[model samples]
Target: MPAKIVVIANQKGGCGKTTIAMQVGGTLGRAGNRVLIVDADPQGTATRWAASAADESSFPAHVAGLAAAGGKVHREIKKYLDSYDYILVDCPPAVDSPVPQSALLIADVALVPIIPSPADLWAATGTRGLIERAGDINTALQARMVVNMLQSNTSMSKEVLEVLEDFGIPLTLAKLHLRTAYRQAAVFGGTVHDLGREAAKAVQEVEALAHEILSLFKNN
Candidate 1:
């Protein structure tokens, strides 16, 4: 079967798009899925993370940088479809960026990560427009929003969720919280799964997200 292409995208920076992509891809790979991560952002955040690995086996997924493939990216990624179970595209932070649009063209699902803030919510609207426009060309594209960097027991987080519920975008129940484990994992060149007992919560969050995404694919 061809790989299910998922684009981790948001128009705004600091939304943790790269973190989510790596975690989700790593989770799936650890679960025995053949996963490939395409670094589409010119900043090469995902590429850098892959490079920081202590060893090739430290990170679960295979990563390749293809910054700004533009309209050709959709067709370019096709060559890898038959070789992997999942392909995740780490898109640029700008909605106008060509890579995001190109990734959307071939994506089965677009996972938008939004931080719990009014600015992030506003940024999501622009991303939604980009996703909708891509939908005109790629009819199979399904967009879902995931809350990232959420602080538990905070009123701001609650408000963000309430606002997003009315945003007309499908929100995933698997939300990622703000935690040091994620940062430590990034620095240590591994995912939360590689962390010790201190990262158990972070590991669980990633696993849950991976399960949710797989379920979405299965249903679709």
Candidate 2:
């Protein structure tokens, strides 16, 4: 099967892109698929979290690595890509960058994480333009938007839902609600599974995402 490459991206910083990538990768790995995580954030937050998990629980299924930059990044990606079943690239925060461009160029599936705000939607236009410029993407690639860190009971939440609908982006029904467990789980070097309750629910959500991703590979 052709490897499914997904870049968890957003032009804005602090949108939980890294967290989403790591958690999704972790969930997939736990579900028995060989998962490879590329920490493209130069800051290496995802790499650090993977390291913490390895040090604490000795997570056996995850293969997390630091991503290279410049034109060489794509070369490095191509070199070791086939060894895993799935590749999750944690793209940099900036919208304009060679790394994100390279990632989008090769990505079979791109996931943009939106924080459910109008300002965030406005910032997404640049990323959308980048995707638009890369034609024939539907043949070799695809893209979707997922709402993260949602607080569904607020008025802003309703507005955000309307915007996601009007904006014509596919919103994932499962939400990573703004909960203390999300923060606590990350610091402890684990995911919602370790924290329990809503965190576990969050893990289930991501696991469902993993299943959807696996289906994409099957249909291909």
Candidate 3:
């Protein structure tokens, strides 16, 4: 079977799009599945994260930069469809960028990461529209909103969660908390699993997310 394509995109910057793409892709790779991360963002953050890994223990998944492919990204990604179990495209935050649309065209699922804030929620409207439009072209495309950097204790976070419950996009049950371990993982060029005991909670969060996402494919 061809690889499952997951496109991580959000209209707002600082929503942790790269982090989710890397962590989930890494977790799947670590589980012995062949995984590839298509760095579709011009910023190349995903490429840099993999490059930061040490020679002895490089990032589990292959990182490929396809930012230059722009609107033709889906066509480019087609070349690797049979070579991996999963291909995750990390899209740039720019609302005007064609990368997200191109990616969604071929994606089995689209993961839209949103920070728990009024601004983030407002910005997500544009993404919701984009996904809805993409669905018309790619009828098989599914989309879920993954809440990131959530602070459960905060009243603002609570309010945002409440609001998102009615947000057009369905929310993922697994959420990422505001944790230092996530940042550490990027610096070390690996997933939360690489941080050892310090990232136990983060590890659980990411693993749960991976499991949930995989279940989507299984159910289909």
Using TM-score as the measure, which candidate wins? Answer: 3
lDDT of 1 by residue, 26-116 (tens): 8898888999999888898888887788986778899988885666787779889999999999888865677888888889999999888
Shift in Å, residue 105, candidate 1: 1.1
Q: Model 3 over residues 107-169: C-alpha lDDT tens digits? A: 999999999999999999999999999999999888899999999999999999999999988
Candidate 2 vs candidate 3, TM-score winner:
3
**Ten contiguous residues minimizing lDDT sum, candidate 2:** 57-66
Name every residue pair that clashes in candidate 3.
none
Tens digits of per-residue lDDT, candidate 2, 1-220, equal 5456887777889878887787777777777777777878777887777677737445434545545564456566666577887888888886556777777778877777888888888888777766655535545666677778788888997897787876644666556667777787678777667776756667677677666665656655
Report the number of the highest-lDDT candidate.
Answer: 3
TM-score of candidate 3 versus the correct structure, residues matched by position: 0.98
Off by over 4 Å in 1: none
The whole-model C-alpha lDDT of candidate 2 against the native structure comes to 0.72
TM-score of each: 0.96, 0.89, 0.98
Instruction: Compute the lDDT of residue 214 as modeled in candidate 3.
Output: 95
How far does residue 22 in candidate 1 sit from its true spot (Å)?
A: 0.4
TM-score of 2: 0.89
